[model samples]
Target: MSLKRRSFLKGAAGGGAALATAAVVSAPAQARPNKVMPPQAVGLLYDSTLCVGCKACVAGCKEANDLPVDVSTPDALWDTPLDIGPKTFNVIKVYAEGTADTKDQEKNGFAFIKKSCMHCVDPSCVSVCPVTAMTKHPQTGIVEYNADACIGCRYCVASCPFGVPQSEFDTPTPKIMKCEMCKHRQAEGKIPMCAEVCPTGATIFGPIPALTEEINRRKAMKAGEANVFERRVIGSGDTHERPAAKYLDHVYGEKEVAGTQFRHMSAVSFTKLGYPELREQSYSSQSEGIQHSLYQGMIAPVVVLGGLVWAAKRASHIEDEHPEE
Candidate 1:
């Protein structure tokens, strides 16, 4: 019998073919671009299996950005937010199932996922900014927003495919909030704070090339195998050895948004922590290409505007010549 996607009843996974054969025919991971960044601009690769869900990265991000806490309970002293929002640029959210003991397994496994600005390869926020308020740095590809140039239109908030930017709704003079990859600290030769303070080495900072190698090493191992996980940045000597959680054979942001600067690997199905089932081609990149092709140098629009002005003037002159008619 044919089975639906969410069910394990009868179709794809349960088809009567050899398991090896079916795996070979299953879809391949999306291809990413060879677009280059500067020598020093840094990013992170997070393995969900390595994370202990300690919330240290979230706290570190808040401290690094000098941002205030988004409190869920006014009566509580420790300001823990349930999700990313205007006051919180990063958050560690949890997903649970029955018993929730296994790390990456789908049936009853629980896992932690870190959420923040994806820093998209082709950012929708950058494309839709009317005044260049949201911009991609040439070297780092970090999307930064300037509030001075924004008209509070929330174009960026709406256009971002990852829904990263959030407006401060409670304040009178509100501003959109999001991660800028800690560029200010990066200028001082510091890595991103979350990566800096991650104790488990679940989050490591470096170029995409090096990060991919690290991820490959993990994928090569069998479940329950011992591996030394690096915390913070690679080559930093901060590491710990632990038995590997069963990886889900998927990397979250490796190809999402045409490859996010910050990549993710996890043991659990991403949907557990709210990752959307995705299209490989980035909507932001597609949207920008279409817009640029149509409006190159504004030459076409100028010619259309000139024709419109000439028609309006001619109509006015004809009306003056025969006022009565």
Candidate 2:
């Protein structure tokens, strides 16, 4: 073969080999295990069965957080929020089907679901933050955001799986907003306003272990049997007696991304109450693996292109030197 022909063939072969190995080269790395919860982690136990669709918790959260009222209607008379927004940090959404007469019944009933941050053990927001603005407390496991450190990038809002973080759009200067489980109250030795004002004790706060125990106790009670539930926080003297609703075996936060501080239990399906179906694996692990693979393979294409360009240039130079008969 002529020198030019040999060079072109060699370059083509090299390019072909690079293309063939592209998939293997770009394959993501193995995913790591999800993170575990902190020992002294504090969170809330929200029982959907016990909720009465009252806006007391919602009102209390707004007051405690010093958030402005969300005027959903044109008149703007009352503080009516359709969902958690920049103006509203927490909300109670209702799931109704058929007649909706009975509470916590799927066939022909309704249920109330509390909307707020889950405070995930392996939070995506904390992982994706460019600055250390979004942080998960090591001891308490509470996720907090510092607007001063934030550049209003909105990466936290996009990374969150539960759609908890929200950016204010109405004002010129916007900040990300989410529920921090009333951590400010904790400093003052007070519980979350939402939990304190919960008339049915639907929302209770305390250490995760104690809350888990309370959840187990409620699950053990037979359906339609009376059980006394503690109010505000676990070990709180305030209590209320009510018939236990049939609960699902699965706990919402328990095994989801290696668990979350805020846990939930419900007689109705979580999907029916607007909660998304999620796998136990953390999304960060999967994303990081993909990122690593891409980083490794980024130079492959450049090398292949360089070889092709060099071969073309050499062929052109030889053609000019040796004129065709």
TM-score of each: 0.78, 0.85
lDDT of each: 0.75, 0.86
Model 2: residues with Cα > 4 Å off, grouped in runs: 1-28, 292-325
Q: Estimate, for each residue in 1-325, the C-alpha lDDT of model 1 and write its tens digit.
A: 3323443322232333334443344343233333444454457888777788888888889999999977788777786888788989999888888888876666787788888988776677877888998988877778898989888888888987677999999998888899988888888989899888888887788876788788888888888888788877877888788898767677887776566778788877777769887766766556666556545666545555555555545545555666665
Question: What is candidate 2's lDDT per residue for 157-229, written digit by digit as tens?
Answer: 9988889999999888999999988899988999989899998899999999999899889889999999898
Which candidate has the top score in TM-score? 2
Q: Which number leads on lDDT?
A: 2
